[model samples]
Target: MTDTQQQSPQARATARIIAPVRHGLTQAGALAVLAGLIWPAQAACIAWVISGWAAGDTALGRTALGAGLFALGGLLRAALDARAGALLFEAADRTIARERAALIEREIRAPGPESSAAVAALAVQKLPMLQPWITRYHVAMTRTRVLPLVFLVLAFSQSWAVGLVLLVAGPLIPLFMALVGMAAEQASRRQLDEIGGMNDMLMDRLSALLDLRLLGAADRAAQDFRDRAEALRDRTMAVLRIAFLSSTVLELFAALGVAMVAVFVGFSLLGEIGFGTWGGQMTLAQGLFLLLIAPEYFQPLRDLAAAWHDRAAGISVVAELDALDAADRVALIGTGAATAPLDGPLSVDLHGAAALPGRAVPLPSLQLRAGEALALTGPSGVGKTTTLAAVAGLVPLAEGRVMVCGQPLDADTADAWRARLAWLPQVPHFPDVTLADFLDPRGTGADPWAALDLVQARHIVDRLPDGLETRLGESGGGVSGGEARRLMLARAVASGGDLILADEPTADLDSETAAQIVAALTGLRDQGRTLLVATHDPALAKALDREIAL
Candidate 1:
């Protein structure tokens, strides 16, 4: 194993995550009831059969009566045990889900550069990996922690010496299982990483399929995908191998311990040892009960050890998510600057600041008035879009404050201020729904055709078989770039917000079509709506009532 894998903190974190709900008392109660009752139930039945046999009575009838009682006891035990298990399972599932959901929310709130990839990993990869682990954690809590403790207590009552040995030594079973668990945690973590890596590789390849085909590297991408898949398969096999080996080792130890106990009981019955002190020589019935219960006592141990794999795997997913979340945080939604309302037309002013990383472009702050259309013009590398983002409440201000209607915008209540704004990103994401749905916020029959007509997108819609009702598959499929941009603008218009921010709305359109989009935007200005459009189109910018040149 690699050194990094060896130093995994998964075990400690998993224990903390599960520690609170590991109800030993609950497990012990169920197990004690099951163990304490099963022995007498079996012994009583056996004794009845022996008596019927020796007395030459109907042994079958006596045996049937005993078996019927045993079955009832078993049924009662099963019900109690199942109820206990259900409690554990539900707690584990709920706790994990709650933690994961909170993590998701935190991630969304504290979005940063690393957030996109991290979120994708958590949503697409870690969630499924946790399923097996949660199941195992639930089972292990009952079997290893609760059942063994109960068994040791009962075994001591039966024979102090046997009980003492069990109470003192039986823990070695879980201790040994824990040793195996530590090893399995590493293996499971590795397996999960490999699986995530393979998934990422496949996604990367698929996203770049056109590039690979164009470059004549499709064969190479296929080979790389195969290698990744194979690596994952091999790691998975290794995890299975370790699980199998650990389970086998635990079973072997349990079998040996049970067998040794049986041998000692046998010798004591034959008077090979001083049994007078240890319950004065166990009866055949007592010895038989011990023999039968020995396996039951250790049964939970084996199950727990085997089930540890699932718990470890599940914990591994949580661990990965936790690690990613630790790197990025979500900005709290409601924690904007202050509470007072801005009184007049909004204006944003930012000073010298850097744009996105790797592009050290200096940005300057500019102001926009409420009554007119303000066009921001700049070169491609300039912060025109960044400036718009800052104004629209998307990007945080570096040095300056944004004022609306002559009052400074408050951070703590940005939501109230944001409600007055409408923003159409450079590339807006639309769900796989109808254009009509996008245009009609109420989802009722509002003629999307009017909005389409405004942006001159009606021509494009007419070409589509379904028109406004046409399903725009993932992210507006079957729609041209200009049509999609127009659709986004239409949605913004439908939102009916006071301040409209459009980023390069004309970016992929012909000059003639672009003019129509600008005209549509100009029409919003005529409606007393404050409009801000970031673009480099000289003619469009000159046509606007006011221009902010960065």
Candidate 2:
């Protein structure tokens, strides 16, 4: 199956759409308010039925009608409570979504070589696990633990004898659920971690498919995936086993609590015990009322075991996501603090730039006059790209700074400083639109043919069916090596007129084409535009007024 198809159903359900909604009220507060409202409504029905029936003038038919209306009100209250529970569930889901978006953005903007694999795992694998837990577990915990206690207290205000037994037995449901479900929580947490790790490993193997095939290691990769899949299956089964046992245990106790209440009522009716001795003795309807409401109070207990299990899994995910966000915040600040601005003479200072992450090789300082052409000579992978990155303000520098036009530039907002400087990297990215649209962000009329001609790329454009109007095919997907490089140079020159930083601008072209491109570049130099070219070709390096070696 494709990766998208392989995504767990749980992940799809909780897929983050936007920022998460914040948690507004504590579970305790909500339970208190809900239970308070329920108490009055429940009590009013009891008094209405009992008091009306006590009057001798009330007919049997009238009593039954009054009872049915009271039951109808109870049904409406039940529906209202369900709606309130759903509102809280959606709020919790929103909160989780917002948190995930913020974390993902932080990770993307982070500096240097920070791997986002761990962060992605938490967002995709762990965040979904928390969704159901947030909704269902929260509801269960409140209804099982807090609502029962609130009802028991209100029951006491009506009748002390009936209230006493409720107070004693109500707590047993939660106590038993907790004791039995403890192991389930631990198991679910372990299973969740295993699932996240497996997800990471699977993604890694897939991304490295080309490398594994080239190195003849496909079998090893397959075996590794198989082992991880087996481990995930084992851990998942362990979690399910514990979950089933805990749920079964909690259900048994809930049923037993109901049975105990029934026994007390039966004995009280027979007068085997005093009315106040065991539980209150009253009419069949009164006894039936307490019996009916007792199980409803603890109904949330039946799901307690599963709720705790899910909660443990969810906490594990939130903790991991928070850590990733913390790390990203640190990286963003670290990149901003390492800008070093170099000084030049009386004219425009073409100061050197350095990016964060260590310099792979030494880059000598550069100073240039308005008319001078400087060449940076180095083999591949020597700090040449790093130098360009520093100048562009993309990477954080370990040491040194870039000063331009005789003024020290702010390293933090390098792009603002670069607005006047032309830059062409080894590989440049362009949009999917036509060449003219790519060059003009503000929709200014730009002659694509003229720009390509200046960069010696006119013939390539003319050969296309649409010429200047032809699309670059999204980040230059269909362009040949030489065409992409030359088009990049055209973009930089078209975009900015002053200083140009060209990395291997002529490396992929024919000798005649290279010469023509060099001639065009020299015209810019003669026109007082400063140029810095990182090249290994001795012929091209020697063509410059000055050269620097790594």
Candidate 3:
């Protein structure tokens, strides 16, 4: 039967809880079971040698045979364990990569701006915590479930009393562990939240450090950051103390259980207690074998106790990832289609379009033919950008159908429609790479320097140390606002999109730059590209072919 077909309900639930590590868990369990089966043979061989010594029958041939069997079992167990560890590590690495990629894709496709700082924390910092859970804790859990039962049945066949003691003590370990785990779960979740908050705080403060310093509040900001770090440290130490205490309690129970089995075997050999071995006295070899296997029976439980904290952390990480993937937030624009180039200039139509669900304003229906240039003019907070976003399909429409190239905009065609258009957001972002690479990632476009020359941004590139080869930081850190705006314009011209959407493209530019932008818009209009610009600039408004006041 297939593995999925053979899985019990409990195993299926576990697989769901840690779906990424299911394959690793199955392979590890099979290896551990093989090792557990070999353990008994190793123990019996040792007992046989000891009993022969006790009987003064130390024949070299029998002794050598037992020694060889013990050695072979030990080597097999070690090899199986090594293989299981390697398999789990690879599985964990792949799982983390897959989760990080999925989170990024979801964020990029989401309708509006998201908390990127929080998403970074989840991907870069929190996601890797699953490694130990899959590699160590998962293996321990599988062994704890499998090896103990195997040892118990073996013990029962020899002496039911020893098996009964293990059976009683085994359940108590998990009982105590569950109680400790409950507290750990709460503490772990708090730690994760605080860490995410700390990351967001650090990013925000760093971005606005100049403003804080100018306002003479830098010292206060520093103090606040210090306080947060100290609080996080204290929380971490508290969790560690609880973890150590739980480990101590579990060890005490495991040690006591093993000691009790040793005492019972000792008494049986001494003829003090003689009522539990199938109405027959145990041979010295049988008693010795039982005693040797006693500690092996509890080893799996001890390993599990050591990995309990990993379980807590892993479950929390999975919960965070699930929250990221849930559709409780705003919807994204498109299906998972690769964007394609437009065949020609396209018309845009907004029928009964309105701002997203919570807004009070309803947008007027409008139609623009191919190659027309229109400007949306409105007061501040009058939904100019919202209208542009609605047109771009970047925000959900409350009661509207947007059509481009005579086809209605839906998830199925959104990506292809977006591909046909170029967007210049009010706030632009550039990846951390050389300027030439940022403008043309595929290295298949027109000369970036030539495009920069068209928008009067060539000087900005020439002034840099490496010219077009100079690397930029996040959000184009080295460039001024005007320079960034011009770069966006340059990129749009180079992209050759049939439709263009520019939001406040001339807001931060000087008069000379504004004139250059006007000329560029004129050139794009003459070339028959449809243009929609959202602006408060009267100069830019006069330059457009038509204006729509919202």
Best by lDDT: 3
How much lDDT does each candidate structure score?
Answer: 0.67, 0.63, 0.80
How many clashing pairs does model 1 include? 18
Residue 345, candidate 2: Cα error in Å is 15
Task: Please say which candidate is ahead in TM-score: 1 or 3.
Answer: 3
Q: What are the per-residue Cα lDDT tens digits for candidate 2 across 3-108?
A: 6446543343234321133233244336434643564456556655665666553777766766676677677667656665666667766766777777676664
What are the clash counts of all predictions, listed in order?
A: 18, 14, 0
* TM-score, every prediction: 0.68, 0.60, 0.70
RMSD (CA, Å), candidate 3 to true, equals 6.5
Strongest candidate by TM-score = 3
Q: How close is candidate 3 to the true structure, as a TM-score?
A: 0.70
Q: Give the lDDT of residue 100 in candidate 3.
A: 84
Q: Write the per-residue lDDT of candidate 3 for residues 1-550, one digit (tens) a residue.
A: 8795477533543564567568767897789778877988998999999899999988998899999999999999999988887888888888888878878877776622336687898889888987877787877888888888989998999999988988888788888888998788778878888888888898888867867998999999999899989988987877797799898888888788888888888899999998778778877988988888888888888888778888787777776765555444566577646567534448788876554533435675678887889999987667788777777777767676888778877777777877777788777788777788777743575688766776678888888889878887767778887788888877886776677899988876789877777788777788787889999898889998899998
Q: Candidate 3 has which clashing residue pairs, if any?
A: none
Which runs of model 1 end up more than 4 angstroms from their true locations? Answer: 1-16, 19-61, 127-135, 138-142, 145-172, 191-231, 255-291, 314-343, 346-350, 354-388, 399-413, 425-488, 502-550
For candidate 1, give the lDDT: 0.67
- lDDT tens per residue, model 1, 33-55: 55445655665576556556656
